[model samples]
Target: MSGETPLRVAFIGCGNIATRQHGPAFQTIPGVTIVAGCDLLPERAQAFTARFGGRPYTDLTTMLAAEQPDIVVVCTREDQHVEPTLAALEAGAHVLCEKIMAHTLAGGQAMLMAARRTSRLLGINYNYRFFPPLVTLKRLLTEGALGEIAFLSVTAHAFCFHHALDLLRWLGGEVVALTGQVSVAADPQVHYPVRCPDFVYVPSRAASVVVRFASGALGTLTATRYEHLTTRLLRLEVAGARGRLVVDGLTLDDIVGRLTRWPEGQEIPTGAGPERGFALSFQQADRAFVARVRGAETPAATGEDGYAVLLLERALVLAQTTGRTIALPSLTPVAEVGR
Candidate 1:
């Protein structure tokens, strides 16, 4: 928290994300130290600690008790998020959870409640919000560069549907209602690369959702894993009464091929270079979380935001199943939803 004392950080799941993004990003921060890494497999934990400089442990309870970390980064699989997050909060540590908050609404709600009960910050890694071009777009929207957003459309990979949902809420406004449709993989042999067979839930390979925002803005999100090209891993276009903005190409390493404004036919500089790539967004996200933990006012997705996205995911699924529009009350408490 102070310049003299480095914040002791620990990782709960030292798998792919921790190894690639979180570990590397934290290493670049000034006043943070990786104290421990915990994983179900000792070899994985050891491998993570070897590169990131931490003690390795196979048990989370043992690591939490021994290390007493200031912050816990939950990089576990989707279904595994809630348990470690709640545990970390109970152990008196703030948490930075990986996305898709949890596999279910109740799980997300439990994690949210735990954070409130412990009075510790619970930030979700909605890293796309930190993409420089998107950051500028948010600033422009706030300044009313586009007067009153009217419509938004997002195209993303099926794996990024949650990110698309988060973007809709972030760039547009609160969603009031939504309808959705999905195309499930017909072949039993076809499974998403990252999701394990034992995982509680696996998202569809392609899906579409239409939403009505509280600002009266209508939006559509279409996501599919069938696309072989990387040109539009994630693309967002927003239109307002005054003008329109388009941000194309949001991939892991290459992001924002172009950011352009309509009518004026002007190209906007994103101020992001190809060298850093989209991975810089993860660093930005990690830096914001660290700043918040140090008692600074920073913009990062909160537990409530994560819960709201999960709620929308649930609504979308319900809409697809029932073939009906789901109305979400803006004022409703997350805990009270789907009860």
Candidate 2:
């Protein structure tokens, strides 16, 4: 899109993610201009705009009408995602929403419907897919370098449950059946140096889910909030008929301290180190969304993808409650299942 008119971008919910990830990311992109920042708190909006080169607004409608942005980035909390995203699409802008999509499947469905009605691009920021090591691993799998997948395993802190779930579906084929169980901390004396706010913390301290994929591959995901070490926040391992791939030590500022491949005995180094790698993932994701908006071919997670993950979440909960294997329905023509 060189020499083309720069894409005007606005942001809703100028919080930590907006300030730390999206704002910095757009600044590095070539054909994007930050036009406005909107937040309920006037100071937050003002502060975000001051640093990101955008005007500030306290209301979404006013921001939409005034800026008429080509893209709206929804950085609000998970529950507040639908309203701003729908408004942005309806007001004639593509939308890139933060993760979790929404608090409920109904809300996610509404956002998807609005995007469909408006015919505007709707992207979800599943930034983990942009990690350099994971990106390389995906390419290897796509190229059949790792024959037929047999089993995949993921272990992470509870905070990464959603991301792990998305990875399972992305790397392993569509899920066919799943069962899950959750455990609470037995010792009431568990403490943290810094506690998350009530809204930020999910109550489940530990959980495990087993899933069977449509391709007959098996997968397991285990997450626990009980650990106090930062040596490794997330680890993913996939075994195939030919070989296996392992990615270890993913955190907010770091991803893939080590990436190992079997048989070949090769170790891939994820460049840029911890200080820059994880943040680079966000930049890469934003760049992909920008390329998609420019009518270029790029890989990005869509609204439908986010909705599918939510469906899996619902199925997992049901499985845990009923102590029965829950079968996941196909999400094709998501509009049909969205409702």
Candidate 3:
């Protein structure tokens, strides 16, 4: 086979996440070039450019005008995601935006609109779904190995409520009715910059949400603030008519009765190191975004997918506040997005 055409790529933010996850992983993906980078802080941008071999800019418009990259990676803060993403999409650049898609509902909607207005593919960097174990789970569901999914129980213990919300969509189809609550209970185990009542908040920080899927299946989502736990733990259980699948880290075991079944796990242990399982997940996500940018295939975390998760979260929040189950609304699933 012949070599593929190189794709010019720009880094829009030079923050810690951009440095750690995006930068290292982008290098491994083929057909990508770090042609330009932009940051509000010139020093940080310059430092990143020096390390990654890209021209640095303090503003996005300047970078877009100069580089005209095929893809723009938005790794800015949660509050700053929409504007730069919209600007990049409008400039005809495909975007891979960081998670927590946007800070507010309106901001999320605006970003959605911008992607629709332009034909450029927009994707959210939802790294968790790219996990090898999770990927296996999705395939199992699609292959009918899991039978009809009756219920999904997810236990997310950290600042990753979005992942839990996104998983609901990933596994249980669209949500029709949701009732939830976010509570504040004192715990000394976790530390974060964003503060809530009793250092806890609802939906995002710590919450119990019950999602009723359109197919009549039910899912229960719960996230808690553990006082003594330092490591992140995600426990997802999908119980169907046949059996239950429990996966933690690299091990995926199908439990029908007292025995484990099939390819039990990966060779490396789940919490072995920072460079193993989850690291591989991020690398997979980087490649997926790169593939989408190269016109190979749409990423698993498409703009429509991200917006759907946001809409579900918004509905869950309203349900928590109103003391009633909120019904899902009709949404525009057009690939284009704008604000």
Candidate 4:
């Protein structure tokens, strides 16, 4: 919007994530304002207002009606996302929803359907896509510095299944079919040392997923919750026909021992800066939504993308449960969730 006024934004679900991540991130954008926030807990809402600079409310309906914000940030729990999101979209506001889109496929579908019916933009917060270093990796792969990505493998730690899924979709083309192996730990209370607030841990103790992309590339995404290995959890290896991107330690492997520079534009990270690197993607995601509202940049992962992630998550879970290979976007029908 070529310096047009800031878009008025309101947030729902003023919990740990809303107070910590999204609120601060939204403030960093040029044409966005975190005008108000709503939560069931008044104290939490007040805390969010104090920390994030927003008017507090205890009810979403009243907040939406009174504020009439241009954008609504839905930071509710994975299972609680649909209602508030649908209400926001139905009220003629664009939405940016948190990850794991929903707890069930039907829940995701409901949000997707509402956004489609309302014709309002519905963005999913796939924050890892906004990581500066990962952005550098994406540019390299897209520019063919890594020629024809062939095999992708992720040896990641706990609570980032969605990140791995989105990375696969970004680097490899559409997934055609997949088979996976999940190893559940003997103890039910096992926990990983993952520190991010936005990541909702999947119940599986350990997972190994094999995905086949339509572009004919085969990849594996694995997560291990072994106690000692959770701190450094984001190791990735994207081997292409030419070069490769190995992000465990942020190095490029192309048969040569190492490639230092990020092919001219690697060092200079664009968009939001590093002060919020812990939640870098959320800041960038907020920026993207505001840009779209102002007719500036196009958003990548929309509600459909969120639905796809939920489907992927569900497919993996179903795979683990039924001991069978699952096709993309296909699962046994079930009763609607959170109805």
Candidate 5:
């Protein structure tokens, strides 16, 4: 800990996510200490601690109890997310979890309920907005640079639909109703795991959804998993009344640093800056979480936001399975006011 009592950060699952994204990023965030790391396996946590300079443990409860971290990052599989997140939040730690939040709406809401019960911050890793181009796009929309958005078209192949859904919600607004296709796998009993290794992997391996935003603008999202494709594939077309914005790919240089994609005549917003790494976006996320802890700003993505994304994900699957246009549901039984 350094500089006026740093926030102590603990990692619940120090696998690839903790090793790659959250670990290094947390180490660099000002006033944040990489206090402890845990994994179901000792070797994984040990490796994280060895590089990231944290104490390592095998069990989450023991680590949280002994170290009393200020923030817990749940980098476990989606199915494994709720337990550790709930445990840490109940222990009064702010939590940041990898997205698609959870596999089901109830699972996501359970995590939200834990945060609500404890009044701790629960944030999601919806890091797409951290891209400088999209940041600028968000700014343009906010400042009325694009006027009222007309429609959006997106094609993405991600491990899950959460990020794509977040982009749609971010570019447009709340979804009213949607219809499309969702499937776990082309082969029954062969739904492949993308990156997740530890837990039972259950996610739509392919998805296509047509979103009707509450703003009355419409959008289409297509997502699928290419188990063999080495490169990321993403494209966004945002059409507004005044002008149009299109974004391609999701990498540091490919997405944010590539400035040539800026709308025909206008420069990127004067103050829009690149958030260096897609990994670096985790740092930006930590900065926001720390800011929230300091009462200076809000966390990047709230529990409710993550819950809403899950709703859209589940709804999309439901729409395809049931073959009906499904109206979106409230995040909870009723909205959690002022969340």
Candidate 6:
């Protein structure tokens, strides 16, 4: 076993996310060897292997037995996450499964159980938690900078599963309960005919969710797909024991501490330098995975962490379905100071 050799990894999915986010970011991180690739689709596996330098395989079991990767990156669709993640854990490989966590509660539980049974690290790619500014804010929260942490307000839309899980995990603070409402608003103007074919229409959702954390902190998450442009608006207000702070346009996070204040109408400090791209957060997450593989660090979002997030997500969906608040399941707690 070449354990110390650049930690070998297999990419289980070769879709758009694997290409645009994970694949490109893997090229930037150190101590990573993307040794094998697999997908149900042979062409996608071949294409990914061609672009990223790996052996392409159609079956993950075969790939695992042959390549013997120390880590597996499961960037597959949310519905397809459980099987591969379970397989990898059973094979004694750590897994980084992309999020929502899974399509359903049962699927997510299976993955969690497999990880626990095998005692292998399982991480869900809740990448937004890695955003530099968010990390800084989390540190401040640990110091009780925000007076009482009265309420948390969030305004954003669907993030293709991966992005949504990150924000929920980061801001909610170990959710104890969830109540959600999903609404659809249709626009006749949204329907437009294509030049060569029939008509194409865009669909949108308006969701309002309320989450209560174990520490009594509350978060109100409102999502609507009616923005003028496709963008994310992440705003946090942590009212501490003495003062309050707000984080906006998180890309300029290096100057995070110098940002806005609470109670409104106060002069906000500005950060220097132009705000860069969102891709940086994804890169940070990939680097964290590599670091964990090398025993340099533990993953920010572990398999149990993934399970917790997925549990909350399931509760939210159930809340939406039954129009009632759902209680969070009991967690096998870990000892992480100031988390």
Clashing residue pairs in candidate 2 (N, C-alpha, C atoms within 3 angstroms): none
The 0-to-1 C-alpha lDDT of every candidate, in the order given, reads 0.84, 0.82, 0.72, 0.71, 0.73, 0.67
TM-score, candidate 2, is 0.91
Q: What is the lDDT of candidate 6?
A: 0.67
Worst 10 residues of 1 by lDDT: 193-202
Top candidate by TM-score: 1
Give a tens-digit lDDT track for model 3, residues 118-219.
878889988777765566677677788768779988887656566778887887788877888876555543445443221122233478889889888899
What are the models' TM-scores?
A: 0.92, 0.91, 0.85, 0.84, 0.87, 0.81
- For model 3, the stretches where C-alpha displacement exceeds 4 angstroms are 185-205, 227-230, 250-277, 330-339
* Model 3 poorest ten-residue lDDT run: 251-260
- State the displacement of the C-alpha of residue 4, model 2, in Å, after optimal TM-score superposition: 4.7
For model 5, the superposed segments whose C-alpha errors exceed 4 Å read 1-5, 183-190, 194-205, 226-232, 257-277, 330-339
Ranking by TM-score: 1, 2, 5, 3, 4, 6
Q: Comparing 1 and 3 by lDDT, which wins?
A: 1
The 10-residue segment of model 2 with minimum total lDDT is 192-201
In the range 1-339, model 6's lDDT, one tens digit per residue, is 434447787899998989888888887666677888899999999999999878999998999999989889998875678788889889999998887566655676677777777878788777767655566666667667675776666665433222443465565577777787766556644322211011001124566678887778777766555643233445555555566666665422232323456565453533323534656667778878777766676335776676666565556567767788887654332222113
Query: Highest lDDT, which number?
Result: 1
Clash total of candidate 5: 0
Looking at candidate 4, the ten consecutive residues that score lowest on lDDT are 250-259
> What digit string (tens of lDDT, one per residue) describes model 1 on residues 53-96?
98999999999999999999999987789899999999999999
Compared with the true structure, the alpha-carbon lDDT of candidate 4 equals 0.71
Tally clashes: model 3: 14
Tell me the spans in candidate 4 whose CA falls farther than 4 Å from its real position. 191-203, 227-230, 250-276, 298-300, 329-339
Q: Which candidate do you rate higher for lDDT, 2 or 3?
A: 2
